[model samples]
Target: MESVVIFDSPGKGRGLKAAKEFWAGDVIFSEASIAAVVFDSLAERICHSCFRRQEKLQRCAQCKFAHYCDRTCQRAAWPEHKVECGAIKAYGKVPNENIRLVARVLWRLDKEGSMVSDMQLTTLDELEDHINDMQEHDLKELKVDVHNFLDYWPRTSKQHLIDDISHIFGVINCNGFSVSDQKGLQAVGVGLFPNLCLVNHDCWPNCTVILNHGNQSAVSTVFHSQQRIELRSLGKIAEGEELTVSYVDYLNLSEERRRLLKTQYYFDCTCEHCKNKTHDDVKMGGKEVDGVKPSDEQVKEATDYCFQMMDKMDKARLNGDYHEVSKICRDCIEKTEPILADTHIYLLRMWSTMSEVKAYLQNFEEAAEYARKMVDGYMKLYHPNNPALGMAAMRAGVTHWQAGLIEIGHGMICKAYAILMVTHGPTHPITKDLEAMRVQTEMELRMFKENEYVYYSMREAALKNKPMTMLHEPRSVEEGIKNLFHRK
Candidate 1:
């Protein structure tokens, strides 16, 4: 009973629509990737057999390219690994990610017509490759990649010529989804979810994909094991509402978003977000913004400074230097406080990063405070049900949980889960992890309070009935809170 209703649109070609009303925190559907390849950069870091991010990894004895946690993982991966191993041994290096994915697609098609569903919920033939729409340089680069991938085919599988390989390339260009970790931090792999690929892009999308549990072992995994593309309702969806997912980060400026959509997806987004200019852009038109705010030029200068500071903080954070990152972020905050909006992307990001740094260093009280600030910022910046909003709450919940404020952590996590279900789906790994923590925290609280369930039950009812809406018009904090309390 997965969500899979197709409808035609005047401009969007075949599009997915909700078959029934979906509550804000509901899962629309979940499916494993048909073709998946762990990126080379993530190979050593993540278990090749199970995709787990772990340090104690065992390399495949023969190929040396595959790393598993144990013999069990190595054995479970052997079936697929045998072929990939042979290909790598023949080539003397692991193939590029796109090449590997194409190989997986072709191999799966030859062995099993479709990877996820044999009934053909969707088809490669129906996918719009946008090959002609791609830039000339990209096309040429793809052609070379096709040739390289074609060499991996077994003698029997090579029956299809270069043209066939090109079609696979086109399909990938049209529908590939980067498989990121549970946190949506980094894309460690690429996967093709045939049924999920039916989703069309909306600049302000109603749904988002969350990766649920992926394989954790190299030795054994479930039959449909690579990765699951769990589609979650990002907001309350009425029956017949178009089910869409953003192909790019929602924070990208309007112009940048449209450009990426056009170049990559072969369509210009005309969604509401793209249709109306942003506050910054609108200010240029001489309209009065709703709140007391710094002049546009002043805001821009502060934002620019924050961006540069963020870049430095990011590099330091990546290299595991938390001390430097924390200082940079604090300076970033001090400078931005005067001119930038409270919900400025840079400001929110700075707070979120500092919270993470504190959490990493086990400064639970400080982490909780910073994370709570992030939650408020997210509430102002993103949609009511945005995954980022949920993630912010979850971060705060974890810090509270670590600080032994089980009651606070339990409530925050429960709230976070409700929002995450809308954004990451109920089954997403992130959602599941948070939910697990909530349960554990609740159990601990029960040992002390004994009547905690009553409170959460009432809170749950409130969250379920909260109306979904687009954010912002009140550029000031007062109106924002006034609007929130007034929401149905």
Candidate 2:
């Protein structure tokens, strides 16, 4: 429990504070989840083409396992299934629910395995042990639904599937469960781990964790890294403070947010925002009116004003209002800055937006500077291979090119292209954009060199035709050309 209490961040209804002082840029925690799934077992029982389970189904010729109802469903699913078929066949047995859940969690960890480490796996093992010690009622309740779900399936010729699946459930019972009729909600994927999950919730969390689709894997990636994988403070934490993170989007209304956190995370938030709405209401009132206490309508107006301002900022660039875009973006930064720290995602967006606007306004130098900051912010929030980071790198490269720094521009663009190629692949629109920019930059550099050569030749001709003067500024045509070329 003490290990889980890594930070003290007080706000909204819950706070996340540092259990120990963490240096900047450390990977506080990382867990993997499943990114993709092939419900082959489910497919075996359903139409592969329509993804609708049925008692009888026909198998596709390409991969004999893909059961389809008709040619239409088969044709529709061909694009997605073609590539996945080989991999699915290779996986051999469909993993048991527990193994499947674990695999799913692992898949959620980004495709890049940079944040993963041996220590995280050990922590997962510890969680398994802890769950095993739960009350008998809890264990029974958790497993009953899962066992029943398996019962519905026709008995497979392979008994190993049932045995393997049962073994997985045994592991899950040791952890925890939320059961429904069709499936048992295992604790492994529910965002719980004594040390990792102990970190409290915040409306404005300093860090974020993305659970891969299907809840197979999770990675708690810092939006910023000042240090390596050491536990650090989100803000300031007292010795005994309970560290929290905003499990849901804090930008939503407090009531809605509280309900989500409670329902999903099982914590009743008493964070500052929920506790002191009066103070927040008053502060909001001050934004709209002089010092007068705002009426309910006035409060709503003020809230709407801030929300609309943010919305306007979001669309300003699309609408082609550069000046308003910049102004509104900056205004948002100013207003949100106090409530949301620099590491907040919203703040990072504001910084990036400002950088983009600067670039569009032809302030290349400033744009480049802001672009660097945006890159840093993105790197902190996302893994190195994230498309957003690649996009930011491309923007920075463009700014460098605009400022007449050819080498740096080329390097930045090349880096952007490389990363984009990996994350989104060559055919992605962004990858194509970066590739086009690279070509354009190369062409401009070649033309610039050619222009330099032409200018030098003209200068040489002028020097050669000049007559001798008292100042000793005279030369033959050949000498003049040589001198001008030499000077260049």
Look at candidate 2 and tell me the lDDT of residue 121.
28
Whose lDDT is greatest here?
1
> With candidate 2 superimposed using the best TM-score fit, by how many Å does residue 478's alpha carbon deviate from the native?
67
Query: lDDT tens digits, residues 68-155, model 2?
Result: 6666556655654554454345554343434434333333332324234444422333222333444577557546645653443323
In candidate 1, which residue ranges exceed 4 Å CA deviation?
Answer: 1-3, 114-116, 181-186, 214-227, 278-292, 318-320, 403-408, 423-429, 439-488
Q: How far is candidate 1 from the true structure (C-alpha RMSD, Å)?
A: 9.2
Model 1 Cα lDDT, one tens digit per residue, 147-242: 777676656454677777788788776787766644454556777777776788776678777766554533334543545667778667899889
TM-score (C-alpha) between model 2 and the true structure = 0.34
**Which portions of model 2 miss their true places by more than 4 Å?**
1-195, 204-232, 236-240, 286-488
User: What lDDT is obtained when candidate 1 is compared to the true structure?
Assistant: 0.69
lDDT of 1 at 363: 76
**Ten-residue stretch with the least lDDT total in model 2:** 479-488
Clashes of each: 5, 69
By TM-score, the best candidate is 1
